[model samples]
Target: MNELVLTLGWLGIYAPMALGAASSAIGCAIAGQASIGAMTETEGGYGRFIGVSAFPSTMVIYGIVIMFTLNRDVTPENAGGLFGIGILSGIALMYCGIWQGRACAAAINATKEKPEIFGLSLAPAAIIEGFGVFAFVFALVISAGIS
Candidate 1:
């Protein structure tokens, strides 16, 4: 019983990180697509600013996750060592959600104006943002020591 508990406990710790990785990867893809779509809709120059604005923060979050994971020995057993994971994860999720919402709105608005380039702006970002939510949940669960 003790061994089983320990194993499950360890899983609870590591699973969040794994989920986070998957989520961020997908989210990035969506953000990338949104950026491209926005640029295309705005005649190239206008949408570039949005991408530029989003890029720095996105990179920072990515850097933090990588730097922390690299510097610290993260494992299922040593789960709670990096206490900042939950906070960072939450921020990342929120950022992605907001970004996706904006991208969706942009796409919808663009579609209304010119219905030809319809699905470009919204779908990718929405899909990727879902992964961000997953990452947030994973981080929350791991931080809380809940499987």
Candidate 2:
């Protein structure tokens, strides 16, 4: 069982980056689709739409950072903590990325209709990003105590 636990510990160490990449891909795709549609409809403000679509990519960066932070010797003593924190934080990042993408898509659509409200439309996506930040910060904080 020690081997199994160590294996899980390794899995946990890398899970954040893997899951965060997946999240970024899904989120970017969703927002990209919306941006593409908006671009075809509106001639101006294509840059903003495209820019917004990239917002979800931050999750991967967060994941990479978390993965680095979590990197260390995996022993039975701390494996459980590593697994729990890494996996849970990864899930949180994934959730945030996916929802943030949808939010960005919504913002794009809204801005497409009323360009004046472009800034306001991004509020939801920003809020979602804030949650991701919270997860990232907390993960770092918690991981510091794991050892």
List candidate 2 stretches off by more than 4 Å: none
Root-mean-square deviation of each candidate, in angstroms? 8.4, 0.6
Regions of candidate 1 where Cα sits further than 4 Å from its true position: 46-147
- Per-candidate Cα lDDT values, in order, are 0.48, 0.95
lDDT of 2 at 12: 86
Per-residue lDDT of 7-104 in model 1, one digit per residue for the tens? 54444334334444444455445545555655565654444434432432342354345333433334454434333454455456555645554565
**Per-model TM-score versus the true fold:** 0.39, 0.98
Model 2 — TM-score against the truth? 0.98
Clashes of each: 0, 0
**Candidate 2 lDDT, 19-122, residue by residue in tens:** 99999999999999999999989979899999999999999999999999999999999999999989999999999999999999999999998999999999
